[model samples]
Target: MSGERVGAAVTWGLLGAWVVHDLEELATVPGRLRRNVPQLRKRFPQVPERVWRRAETLGAAEFATAVGVMGAIVGTASAAGRLTGGRSGLYQSALTGFGLHGVMHMAQAAAVRGYTPGSVTSPLVVLPFTLWARGRLRKAGVLRPPRPRDAVAGTAAAAAATVASHVVARRLLGAARRTS
Candidate 1:
């Protein structure tokens, strides 16, 4: 394969692996919150048990929705990247993924029926593993941090895994893409 093709393959491959890991980690976040709920309550005396319980129940739905929304947006961005014939699609798709996620999370929290345990503390609760995963990936020498000129490395990493999964789906059939 040509150098460009190799780059694309590696980029896609790395991104695919990252997406799998990200989804797995995302799946674990609510459970982690459940484990931390008592400590969180102890730390913030004003937070009620009812609030945490509600968040736990709602977390699955919220997370699923967020992932679905982000998946659609990022998929479009990735296709745009491919159609435009530029590698920059990877970066753009990544940015849209995390950016939309952040916005959705904030909106969910501010909107009615937003009472997830980690809603208010998502940054603190989520960032540690997020950081740790990035750090470990960097340590393992698979992915690198975004450059100063490219401020979207972390975001790209976040979307890489999801996009990778889509790529896999796109290979399956048109029907899968539509449903996905």
Candidate 2:
């Protein structure tokens, strides 16, 4: 197989894998948080009231809007990867963040002592796909050895994107509420 073709596949595969993993999250997050946040806050009082309050505010529509915003970002990174043959820093950074996100989901589940959004697919799809794609990128000679800065950059990007998406979601919801 041509490496270029394989590289494109690897890059596009990231979006596909993310969609699968996030489907679980999209399906579960709003309801799960609604059901458990009160108990979770009580049980883990150190988690901060704002965190609990913010989580409680997430309705399905708001969460879906956030997912759509994040999808656009991921889609852009995947396109960059495809165009650059897996050599794009945007693609690599997103890939790293996606993998770390899976790890975080596992930890979230453990910390909550129960199922959490994305936990089902974190191991099954997200992490495995990330590792496989990274290996393929390495074999294609486009891989950069990760540095501490890469991890920090990836993590910060992920966190910032999430926050931005939520902000967008909230603004959209507010606008809709006003119009209605």
Screening candidate 2 with a backbone cut-off below 3 angstroms (N, C-alpha, C), the clashing residue pairs are none
TM-score of each: 0.40, 0.94
Residue-pair clashes, model 2: 0
Task: Flag regions of model 2 displaced more than 4 Å.
Answer: 1-5
Tell me the whole-model lDDT of each prediction, alpha carbons only: 0.47, 0.90
Candidate 1 wrong stretches, greater than 4 Å: 1-15, 40-57, 89-149, 152-180
The RMSD of every model to the true structure, in order and in angstroms, is: 11.5, 1.9
Query: On a 0 to 1 TM-score scale, where does candidate 2 land against the true structure?
Result: 0.94
Top candidate, metric lDDT? 2
Q: How close is candidate 1 to the true structure, as a TM-score?
A: 0.40
lDDT of 1 by residue, 5-73 (tens): 213322232334334434754666667666766766776677777877754554544555555555555
- For model 2 the local lDDT of residue 66 reads 95
Please give the range of 10 consecutive residues that has the lowest summed lDDT in model 1: 1-10
